[model samples]
Target: MNLSFTTKRLNVIEIDASSSMVEHHQLTIALPTILTPAVVANLPGYFQGIDSIAAAEKWLANMLNECRLLMLQSQQQEVVGLLFIYTEKHDAHIGYLLAEEYWGQGLAFELLQGFINLVGASSQWHKLIAGVDESNTPSIKLLKKLAFDERASKENGMLFFQLDLRKYPLEEGTI
Candidate 1:
């Protein structure tokens, strides 16, 4: 997989144990901002007590071992959010979160759209899946806007969504 890519307003880079300390430090500091109470409430069992560099590093290590983790950086080079993808067969399950301060700015749409364009054009993944908490209305709307069809909801209050890449229509001026 490509470790680094760019969108119109952000730089997306894969981050793992081998990533620079500076990048990890930036992410550690940005954790609180990105995973605010509202965000945390939406994401269950994903992040907890990750307030320090040590905790963040450990968390990253554990996560990278199972998923492909990407750091979302703004044009100014500040850590703004993260995107993680877990692949199974021909499907890629993705999750993303942006700093509270960056909310309502269309960044999420841009980020996801750019990602779809990239993966749709270059990867063999047959589909993309996303599971959002039932209470995360904004994310539900965002997924729908991206043409992801709603699948069955899990008993754990998570609503599943999917986008079949073969049937995804390319946007004008996009790959």
Candidate 2:
């Protein structure tokens, strides 16, 4: 299936093993910028001990093997972020990270809203799930703004949220 999409100011492209070497190399260099300590602190068990290029490559390979990874590139042709999705049954669990420099802007909201517009009507998934650390108030606010409902909270301070696509189908220009 075609997995690449574009937003008003960004191009979202799927990155698999089949992706070009240039894309992979760009992602490798962009990883350090995207997954800064401030961003990684909220995501547990991600990019752990990735202090070198070799480690990052291994981690990227493992991630590409397990998840449908999407690279977020800016209009200027810069890799600025990543979106990771894992599917189970008819539900899709998603996680995303943006470069620290781009945090204050509305790119996160646009990225997610665009993604919802892209897949909300598809029959492959009935729900979208996202787990956020309880302390990440900004992310929580963003998801709530997107109409995601809080489903549960774990003892580890992680909040579980889900958006039922059938009930809240996001279409382009409607959001």
Candidate 3:
């Protein structure tokens, strides 16, 4: 198992495919309908395609066993969001979504900070990438606050952001 960290209001852990926590995680993802249209528009196609509980379960499972995602749970143990880090040839692509009600709470910052400290310590990756819809201003700003630089926009109109992890390595025992 990977390291799990606790912040003031959250417990961030590496998700397991067979864990019962998958259901709670599904609930968070399913709440997209209650969010603003702009927030929903920020979700990737795979996230929007989960229309049923079974599909959500499968999505969570695949993310765990195949993609190795991390989960952020609230103090009550409710899954509030997920951090997906896709390690590629030279970069680790990151993507995340939080429960609508959790937006603007700085929880995403906490989650990403924990993830960066945890993963950056053990991996060879130095570059982190995230693709955000140009319309998602909050996400773009969040990435910038984390020191991610904006790259060229893709053909699909998604703006890519890159962060050099080498510039922000965590000190030992900080997490």
**TM-score-based ranking:** 2, 1, 3
Query: Which regions of candidate 2 are displaced past 4 Å?
Result: 168-174
RMSD vs true structure, all candidates: 2.1, 1.7, 3.9
The alpha-carbon lDDT assigned to residue 26 of candidate 1 equals 81
Tens-place lDDT per residue, model 1, 1-175, is 7757898899998887778888877877777667767667767565866767676767777888989989999999998899989999999999999888888898899889889888886788999999998888899999999889899667588999998888656767532
lDDT: the better of candidates 2 and 3: 2
Question: What TM-score does candidate 1 get on C-alpha atoms?
Answer: 0.90
Q: Which ranges of candidate 1 are over 4 A from the true structure?
A: 168-175
Candidate 1: C-alpha lDDT: 0.84
In order, what lDDT does every prediction score?
A: 0.84, 0.86, 0.71
**Residue lDDT tens for model 3, 10-127:** 8877666455565555444654443345445667665665655676666666666556566777998777776777779868898887867889999988877766776565767789
For 1-175, candidate 2 gives per-residue lDDT tens digits of 6578999999999999789999999888777666778778867675656667777788899999898999999999999899999999999999998888998799999999889888887658899999998998899999998989999567588998998988656555556
Q: Would you give me the overall lDDT of model 2? A: 0.86
Best candidate according to lDDT: 2
**What ranges in model 3 sit over 4 Å off?**
1-3, 17-39, 170-175
